[model samples]
Target chain A: MEDEPSSRPAGRPRDPGVAARVLTAVQDLLITNGYAGTTIAAVAQAAGTGKAAVYRRWSGKADLVVAAVLALNAPVSVPDTGSLRDDLVECAMHYARGDERATRVLASLLSEIGHDPQLFDAANRAIGRPPVAALVAVIEQWVRRGAISADVPTELIAGIIPTAAFGSVTLRQRTLDTQTISDLVDHVLLPALTGAHGSSTQLL
Target chain B: MEDEPSSRPAGRPRDPGVAARVLTAVQDLLITNGYAGTTIAAVAQAAGTGKAAVYRRWSGKADLVVAAVLALNAPVSVPDTGSLRDDLVECAMHYARGDERATRVLASLLSEIGHDPQLFDAANRAIGRPPVAALVAVIEQWVRRGAISADVPTELIAGIIPTAAFGSVTLRQRTLDTQTISDLVDHVLLPALTGAHGSSTQLL
Candidate 1:
């Protein structure tokens, strides 16, 4: 999953503060106008940047879409709450809330990307893996400290945690509230992480 | 989340068989072409029917897409292997092999549906809840059979299995091979399902 073949060139920053503003504009455009309606000129105007600046950074609509997704991909720093339960619960909330708008953009971007694997590489490099890697890093530390187990692959376990959150958003049309996320983390996610087996759970 | 406020349907079924054929064509096209490339004309061509026939069945392309997704959305048919290890491991392989093109299509479709609430009901009815509910049913049965704990919510436990498989496919570009799925089931997924706390798994 990790072997993406994109080398970052010395253009501007992949995402600068101005670029973030542009992506925020793109996100707003995405939510309001839908992907079909979003235009480079509209994004440039919204961000108060020049068209040249936008083009200088991203190659075309697909490239800009990926950049916007990357800007949208940034998850806030997860807190080390000393307990896995606390950390995950907090992470889920932060995850669910941070940029509902941005995440929505991903659905649109992925829609476009699925037909074209070339876009997948760009999306993976510019947008996809950073946040996932962050969570995996936390789980890796836990494994190192004997907090979690070495028997489990750090990447796989860490990967499942974020998957629940994104899948909730990806799978359904609901707003993906905090309580729903918390419920997932506390009951389903933790036990799965611990691998506790005895009896089946009651329906929720 | 449960209450979709504006879920009025356009029409009811006329010829379910024809609709089924159209939907099956849609699934094949989606598996083959993806959301962006799928068209009414193409679907009609593939199904050996006219475009009017498809329109009579669904409100639009999105509605048609919903049907295709639901075609593969059978509930969690977790195998009764008489052991959690065997059941979960088998479940992972099923996840890996069963209609992967549909799986990828859903990954993209899911995100797009988040942006369009009008299709929410159609998506849920056609594609969403059956599989998840099935997974929940199977997990609950397992728990009642003394295979898992009644303490966990079935919804939460249900979330984990797919969270691993879908998450793996969507986030990382890995082959969902049988052996890989087996490893995910036996080592990662099964362990997560059981509980990660114990030093070693004692249950079968």
Candidate 2:
């Protein structure tokens, strides 16, 4: 692949803000007009940048859309609250109260995921994996602390957390409130994680 | 308002199979070309029916798509197997391993839901409401039997079950299998419903 103009810097310095502007433009187009309507030319025009500048960042629409989606979900730091339950709640909250724009982008992306392997992998890596990984880390910590049972499937539990949170958002067509998030953790994840056993029973 | 020809005896009786044919055509277009690509003209052409026939059944694209999605889901009769756990498992399976075409249709509909109120309401009523209702019915049955505590927020629990099932399918980019469905019920739903206590204590 040809080196991106940003890396070479042959002429005047590339605007540092160009990347953010492009991503923002993509988000606006994605939310308002959807995936089919958004395009590189439109994004460049919206961002007030040359098409070359947009290309310097992402290869094409799917890559740019993927980057925009990932930007919507800026890396959530894993919660290390000393207890698995609290940490899991923190992770759930990240998704439960996540950017509405991201949810819109995710819906658009999910529609095409079955048909586009590249888009699917990009989304799975950027949008899907982080929260699950955070949950896994928290559950692993709990396992070490002897709070979670040995037989509990940490991976499945991790996957379920984000799924449940975002699923509600998708179904309701609205962002989840604090009460709903609390219910999700209290009623779903914590019970699944603890298997209704000892030590972690206090949340109930 | 002019009565639809199908409802009246105008000329030849409207073919009894027109509705199914049109719904199937919509599903095909939706799966292959997505929501943006599928159109009324194209659906009518594919279904080998006139535009009037399609319009006679549905008001427009949103209504047509909504009906097609509902058709894919058909009606899942709530299973009553003498235990709340079996009933919940049955409900989960309806979603976890639902028709692939329905999943595709749902993805397409979900993408545009934010912008289209007609599509949103149609989808909410057709695809989103039914499973939650079934789950609520099952949970209510258990509550009556005294198997599940009356204090449980059956509505919230009901929402979570399908949310978790559909969410997993969305995340994985594929339908869940039989074992995964069982695990979801045995490990996730049952534990959450019973709060990991009593007869459902096997998982812990």
Candidate 3:
């Protein structure tokens, strides 16, 4: 572990475990009390750390909540299974099986997003972009192998999997099952990407 | 106009326009302040109406907000286009082009849904169920005509259009355009429903 900065107050060094503990506390508070109710002081107290310690890591509630949610989701390690279909299904499932706590936190955060720009940006940066990035990388590999049509926009290609899963959760409050995930890949995504479904004129 | 009840406090009869005025105010508050910021007092003040007038119209914020969102969306009269794809496209477009105020209100309300059961239920009752009902009815008609396979679950079939639009807005903060909407209907919905373009095993 690195030593405390010379500017640090004369005391025992900060616990390396405090960051994880504080993030856990932040997640619990965000889920239980919501954006308005969660406070730095409350999180600090729950984590058994000082408010300054929490501040040292995250600038404010929006920043803290973003980090907390990211931790809850962990990172989706993109799988390279050679087949674009397999890669896409595995990528989609990462979001389909989001943990309950993360779902609750996100559900609770949705209403606040329109009103708070910072929180929205934080969420998109931490949660939204990573999956898209992973998907894009996978699609690039597929394009290299002449698997997927090169003409298909990577953004649109990347969008179908997560968006399908997202649509299920948003409208039905249900997760994408194994069947739905595969269907989205084979019937919807693969056809769209391969230019084998409907007329190309239909696409954006 | 119906007379006030005999036990009514004698005063000028309730304004014929109060309901519309109050609902408009509720919309403004919901769009501007979000659910937490919008209060009965603020709504009454914005409407230039008395607290009692607002309360008489809506039981609380949840009721008021639901009514406002519903009014903004307006009821979609599912078109009898004789084609399920056309009907689905038309219905999905109704939500895709939601006015700025309605979009803002919905984005704000999304985060609050999990914590407030009353709001969640009210939102579902007014803003959520209508589209589903309309979609189900359309699918039923299609089923009767042998336009779509009977094997496809009505709920899954109904979910695609709106959920696709919803996912677009949620993750990307983008609305579904005419082209994307048409593509989703033609490429995703039609293929899934008709069991064409690929194997039928992929459907929900």
Give per-model TM-scores: 0.72, 0.84, 0.75
When summed lDDT is taken over every stretch of 10 residues in candidate 2 chain A, the lowest stretch is A195-204
Give the number of the best model, judged by DockQ.
Answer: 2
Q: What is the TM-score of chain A in candidate 2?
A: 0.81
Candidate achieving higher lDDT, 1 or 2: 2
DockQ of each: 0.36, 0.48, 0.29
lDDT of 2 by residue, B24-130 (tens): 99989987788888999999889887788888778998888878876765565777988677787778777655565556566666666666776667666667777
Candidate 2 residue A98 Cα shift, in angstroms, is: 4.9
Q: Which has the better lDDT: candidate 2, or candidate 3? A: 2
Q: Which pairs in model 2 have colliding backbones?
A: none
Clashes of each: 15, 0, 4
Shift of residue A161 alpha carbon in model 1, Å: 2.5
| Order of candidate numbers by TM-score, starting with the best | 2, 3, 1
Residue A186 lDDT in model 3? 60
DockQ of predicted model 3: 0.29
Candidate 2 vs 3: which has more DockQ: 2
